[model samples]
Target chain A: MRLLLVEDEKELSRAIKSMLVLSGYEVIQAFDGEEALALIENNFYDGIISDIMMPKMDGITLLKTIRKKNIDTPVLLLTANGQVEDKVEGLDAGANDYLSKPFAFKELLARVRSMIKHYSPIGENTHISYGSIKLSIATYELAGKESSIMLSNKEGKILSLFLKNPTQIIPFEKLVSFMSCLDAKDKEIELYTSILNNKLDAVNANFKLAKLNKGYKVASL
Target chain B: MSIYGDRLAQLEAIVEKGKTLIQEIINEEVKTSGISPIEHFKYRIKCEESLINKLNLRCLPVTMESIYTNIHDLVGFRIICSYTSGVRTVANKIISNENIDIILSKDYIKHPKPNGYRSLHLIVKLKDSDVPFEIQLRTIAMDSWASLEHQLKYKREIKHKDLIVAELKMCADEMSSTDLTMQAIYDLIKEEN
Candidate 1:
């Protein structure tokens, strides 16, 4: 999963970035909300973590700005003030989750995980497990109870999306955007899916892709 | 220029044109016949990511060449009506104009899906634009069934999922009948008046 971590404290920012990196997230650091917006213009992240107190562009204003632009990327606001009203103000301004500072790293990690899951289409899941099938993003592998093998980048990215929201119908257009396919047609989608299905069968995975409303869905067979 | 910028702009214009054309048709029909057939409608362009996914899924290449030709729903709309007959009335009124061409049409209301999904689908080409757009015509009941079906089906983590699926399908059938009965009642009132 990719994340934008915004904090004015250099030491604290480094601490969180390194911890998130060690925990298998791709982290981008911004010193304040101003820098965060600049980064956001050029990049996309699964989730964002920003501190309420900052050098320029306070977190509340930043949250309102992004929400006004209809950017639904999940956000977790960090604040030194743990008051109910402060949290309410953040939620009212469209923050997804909130955490108080001087907090446990474990709690922060937990909040981040849930935020990513809540916005599952962004594919923040490095590890996706469904039924007996297990897919690893870092290793680029899909494994069944009996076997495991390496996956091509395309296969891995597509599977990553499927695993994150197995029940959701991934529209054909979304799959193309996610995979960055240069060209595609519905028939080609069927062909690619069948090829992937054969590989899944070889690995003894318990599910196959299903067609729904001009899109594909993953369901247990 | 960005890679998909041109195609995205084209799709935006297509959707805008479709919306305007639909409004114009509705206005003309009301002016000429007094009773407007269309209840409400909504239109949108498929986002770049989604349009590409659809192109790829259709097995069409995801290139600019395939974007407009193979992915038909890059620009689409849903036309909602209060009565089942209103759907066809509005569709015919819109397409009967000499400048409009009905490239393809499917009467799904007459032949519901196995899961009980029902709607009339039409692909239309304007006089000026070579790229076609999709239009779905459905009654209020049918639209309700569709929206609920989408909500229930996507939340796979919910408990009693199979039971809920079965029940939702049943509800769709009920809604389909309700649509017919409602239309019949409306016709009876019209005949009396």
Candidate 2:
């Protein structure tokens, strides 16, 4: 994902830029709102993160301008003034999101990811397909040529990850990571694996052996 | 015009003719409409002082802001209601005056920005004034929320790393909806009456 970060603080901007880059995102940084506005016209960014206080133009003004131009890209504003009137004005001016300074990196990343996922367009398969089985992420269901089964919430998610990278080996560690509420205990992990395998089998999905590996792979049908 | 000079001129004019303007309008209103001239001039001033103090509007010019154009040629008042419907109630009540004329209005409620905001604005010319001022009628909850949001989110950078922007947006939405819902209850009450 590509993100544009507009902040005046050199240290904070550098730190955030490095962190975002390390997390596998391309980041374009600007020191002030004017520069940020100029860059916005020249580049296509997935998201924008801006500080409210800046030289030449303020964050609220920038947001207002961008919105007037009909740019629907999600904007996350950072501000130091924590006042009721200021917030009302910012919201009134059409900022998509507002964050105060001194924030955690993890929280920032999560917000960015959520916004991107919400606005991203799927190029081809509106339905994620793997082998003979197709899972609709939109409806959260699994469908085959002859029959269709509504997947439980957990099963539906697992199926989505598999469908995204079909015919590929999904390491056990990666699968566990995909399951947000999973525990690290060996028993629970084993149980989760068993449940996943059962669901796949029930759905008559393309499968392969566990191979005594740390993760499982989706084999050809 | 320099802000100070312009504002001072306005204030001086208001103070100079405030009482006469009030008395004349009250007499005229009572004669034509037969309503009691319970015109509380101080109520309007007190409301202005309270709003200025509460909103920390010290930076504003010391002019006839937040006027009470009802009695004075220049009047401003903020109608603070218990629910959102109160905004409409007060607005409709004011407009019911055949002597009043609406100059400008804004409906922030029906068409809020993406950030989730709602408010109603009305500018009315009282029975006698050629000049128009402002009257801001908003639910107390909306007023309070607007105040908090200004301080917490819009004024400066937020330092809270725990709550993400999405969470903040959700909170804003909930508060906005609550304001409207509270207003709806008031509407129901008025209907019963």
Top model number, TM-score: 1
Looking at model 1, residue A15 earns an lDDT score of 95
Q: Write the per-residue lDDT of candidate 1 for residues B1-193, one digit (tens) a residue.
A: 5445756677677778778877887888789867667888998776767776676677888677777667667678999887877887888876787777899998776556667688999998888778788999998888988998887777757898678766776576556645654564566556557
TM-score of chain A of each: 0.57, 0.53
Separate clash counts for every candidate:
23, 39
For candidate 2, write residues B93-147 as lDDT tens digits. 5666566688878776544444444467666554554656556666665566566
* Docking outcome class, model 1: incorrect
Model 2, clash count? 39
CA lDDT of every candidate: 0.75, 0.59
Native-structure RMSD, model 2: 26.6
Across A160-217, the per-residue lDDT of candidate 2 in tens digits comes to: 6555434334556545644665554444344445554544443456663252454454
